[model samples]
Target: MLKGGCRLNGKKRCLLPLLLAGVLFSCTVTFSAAKKIPTILVCPKTLDNSFWGNVRAGAMTAGKEYGASVIWKGPTVETDIAGQLAIMEDFVNKRVDAIALAATDVKALYAPVKKALNAKIPVVSFDSGLDPDPTLCLIATDNYKGAFEAGEALARLIGQKGKIACIPLISGASTSILREKGFNAAIARYPGIRLVAVQYSESDVAKGMAVAENILTANPDLDGIFAANEPGAMGAAQAVKARGLSGKVKLVAFDASPMEIEMLQNGTIQALIVQNPYNMGYLAVKTCIEALNGKKVPKRIDTGVAVVTMDNFYEPKIQQLLYPAGNSGK
Candidate 1:
């Protein structure tokens, strides 16, 4: 009764029994595939800032939803490209299913990223993208556009004709460089606006405050300031408030930190260009799943951005998108 030599239930199996056995085997394979859980390694640039924290939240949400084992790790402070690379190397050695990274140094990450690729590991770049790599996919905000929006908002707040200073976190960071370029381009559209000075804060709030104090001391008449990130913005706001020039100097900053939002609500900061960090994280996880499943995905996906001010701060989508779940909606 058996098609081959094997017998089922102590007797030679007929063609019908063989077909039923094949069906059962196929069902077993399907069940095994469905029960398999994917493991993901998420490495943000740093957890010091709320931006990366939001990214971690999104990744965790995805992990929970998709039955994935997610390991979220990063540096305590940014600018530690070496530390990030070392972590990535360890993750690769562990043979994770995939890696999602927010690269601190675009060029410095080349070696480690390539190392992961050579080991047949998929890497997805989120938040901050690395230079074009054939083996990596990028999910991020369009930095240039976001910065341009901040510049336009600043120009409007300062009445188009004013002196503004740019306090960027890092001079060589690719995202910061693009944001500066966009900010400069936007200001170029308005002939009355002039960029007085561009200073590097090295991603330190105290350093940003010190630089802002020195700049304000030198140019007391300056009417506008554009801080490339949240720390610099908060530091500048503190400096302005300390000097009792809160309403006099218009502040337009990047990212919507709780402090920055409070400043906006309190009339200290005029506007902030907020990036969708949650979306960045969600998309990064989705992309990794797709890639691992042998599905095609884009090399770069823009998470888009928004400008947050006092007027629309309470909108539902804005609240959910910015604050996510479990975060104090402060």
Candidate 2:
């Protein structure tokens, strides 16, 4: 009986070893088959502007929702094309799953974007798009439409036919170029309205203010002004105010900075064409994730636009998207 008992104990020990081996093999297979979440790199023009901050928030939201890591990095200034290119290259070298960029120079970014594509890393352009490569998906506002609306608003404010000057941040940047084209096209509809001058400020607030000052001095009869972005608009408004012509000259600007919104409320500025920057950031990341999953995303996604004035500026929907709880002035 004792011998028989020892044999049964030995058999139980053998079975235990088999069970442990089976469990270890199953765990290894499970880990190997687990899905790997892709990492997304977001390279904005700059983080100093509130507009880009909204974009970063949007990208973060998408990153959280999709279980992906997001790296938001960019130059402190807008004109840092070389800095932007370096960031793109870094992402490519790290073998990031994807990159979303707001190109400082559309033509200058072609080589870098192409290199990313060659490495099988997908590239998406947000805010400012690349013109060279047809494969890059672009997520941005319909700048022309938004700028046209702004021009119409300015024309209405001016009432009589007069000369309007435009101070754009950058001459050749895709967004500014589109805005200039749209503004010119719309202003052309009104026979009395004329674009007197177009100046490039290099996206510098101080330079924009100085340029506006010079233009105002050169053409005191300038009845209206359009700024392609928030900083440009604010700087131009300051120049107009310094000359004691705030309400006298109609100002139509882009981007709804807190100061800009306040100006709109106080009647300092007539109108603002606000871009859905948050949506642009969010959609850029979402599209990238979709692409990674082999899902088709549209090459050009218009994140949409809004025209804000004192009347409906405080609307709940716009406030929730633009100002959110902690970010709002009030």
Candidate 3:
């Protein structure tokens, strides 16, 4: 029915329809403008840990630097391959300008990555990757080398004459595989150091602790232990503390966590294999943006790693790697 001007039963002619039309037109213009600016999606292993938090921050910082809209999200934890794959598929369908992925599983993610590439989306793998393809551009720590250093550090700390064990993050994780290889290589050099046991933590803290406890029980004379990643390290540290083996166990671990830092201060772990996760995040986004802008980017970027012992813990460089953006809230 008709009313005053263009509305029915309204005192002031119900301008609602005209107002909505104006708003719709304005929204369309804004959206069209937004589409012109490139959109990048940065998907990490998870958002729960301090490691991934810094990754997220560095990625957003680069996004702001490059004037690109960045969407940072992933599974709740590192083990959720299906969740990560779904996000990739969604981004592919949306035709995102590019994607930076820290793959959940090495081989499982290869197909999804190829799918994104086929859909004309540039993909950059950071922190970890699918395969040994430098063409995809991997921004990550030199895991094998770093792990070898950790192994040597541990051997020296233990005087290379006792049984030791390794608690890896997971079996199929590329980082885990490389670190394991490097560790084996290092251990071979120390004949006096016997490899009594090796366990997989499935990237779970509790499992890491349980595995540590079991290994310690099975070999009470165990001299040293290496934890492959943050969670396993934390779990191993816990197990050592629980058994009152803190200083006696000669623990060496990878990555940095609040608990790990506390352990370092308290003498739970003799050394930490620290990686530059923040740089990995920043550079991944930067590379993706550059590619979108038609700039050629390198396919392999080692973000680098270092051994953080008490001797070098307070140094400026180690401080930056230990605490990126001066925030270690985890």
Candidate 4:
């Protein structure tokens, strides 16, 4: 007597239906074991911020739709270049099917990115990118243009003539560099505007606040400020609010984090240069999947940016930008 009430001692006496059922079960198990879902690794500069959280949401949404496993990982802080590189190397060693990276350091990421490419893994960059652009596709906002628009807006808020300062996220980062340049170029257009100081926040709120405080202390006559990223914006807004200069010192910052939006509403931040991080993450994953499927993807995809102010905050399009359905605009 065997498990299905079939005697195995004499094979010819066994029930044909039971034997066929057992064979079918074994075949089904084997087939199920053979199929494997593709895995995609999405690495942002840091994982602690709401901006990155929104990006993660978008990436995960795309992963679910495309039937690929999404692994979201990154350093706790944006300045941890070594940590990011290590994470990338480990994932490459694990042989993930694809990688979407918002690299912390432009030059340091090339080696691991190159290795992943050599191993036939597709790498897509988002938010920030590598120096030489080794990734198959770059899905991100046009940082330069966004910053330029922010500068123009800030200048307008200050009546186009006043002392200003800049708080950029990371000095050596590609996005930071481009943003700073664009901001300076825009400021250059208005000869009456004077850039009084510049500082690097490393995308840390406290650091941004400290720098903003110092800039304010050094130049009491400063009329406007531009903080290049979300954390920077929060810090600058706090500094301005604390100094009782909410309206006195005009502030235009980047990214529409909840805190930033609140500041904008309260007039602490006059305007926000909003980037579609959700789109960046979504497109990064989508592009990676396309590349893995042997389809050609564009070398670059601009997720686009928008400037938001109190005047048009309630508009339907701005509301959509601020609160994308699945994303809380974190």
By TM-score, the best candidate is: 2
lDDT of 3 by residue, 1-330 (tens): 563465455735576778889999999999988677789989988877778887888898998998889999898877898999899889888999899998888988888788888887889999888865433589999999999998899999999888999998877788889999999899889889999999998788898999999999999999999999988999899999999999999999998877788899899998999888878889999999888878888878999989998888888878878887675433
For each candidate, give its TM-score against the true structure.
0.88, 0.91, 0.87, 0.90
Local distance difference test, each candidate = 0.85, 0.85, 0.87, 0.91
Across 179-275, the per-residue lDDT of candidate 1 in tens digits comes to 9998999999999988898997777788889999999999989999999998899889999999999989999898887888888888889888888
Q: Write the per-residue lDDT of candidate 4 for residues 261-306, one digit (tens) a residue.
A: 8898888999999888888888888898899889999998999999
2 or 4, which is superior by TM-score?
Answer: 2
Please give the lDDT score at residue 75 for candidate 1. Answer: 80
Off by over 4 Å in 4: 1-33, 326-330
Candidate 1 — which residues are off by over 4 angstroms?
Answer: 1-36, 326-330
Q: Clashes per prediction?
A: 1, 0, 0, 0
Name the lDDT of candidate 2: 0.85
Off by over 4 Å in 3: 1-35, 132-135, 327-330
Candidate 2 residues lying further than 4 Å off, grouped into runs, are 1-35, 326-330
- Whichever of 1 and 4 has more lDDT, that candidate is 4
Best of the two (1, 3) by TM-score: 1
Better of 2 and 3 by TM-score: 2
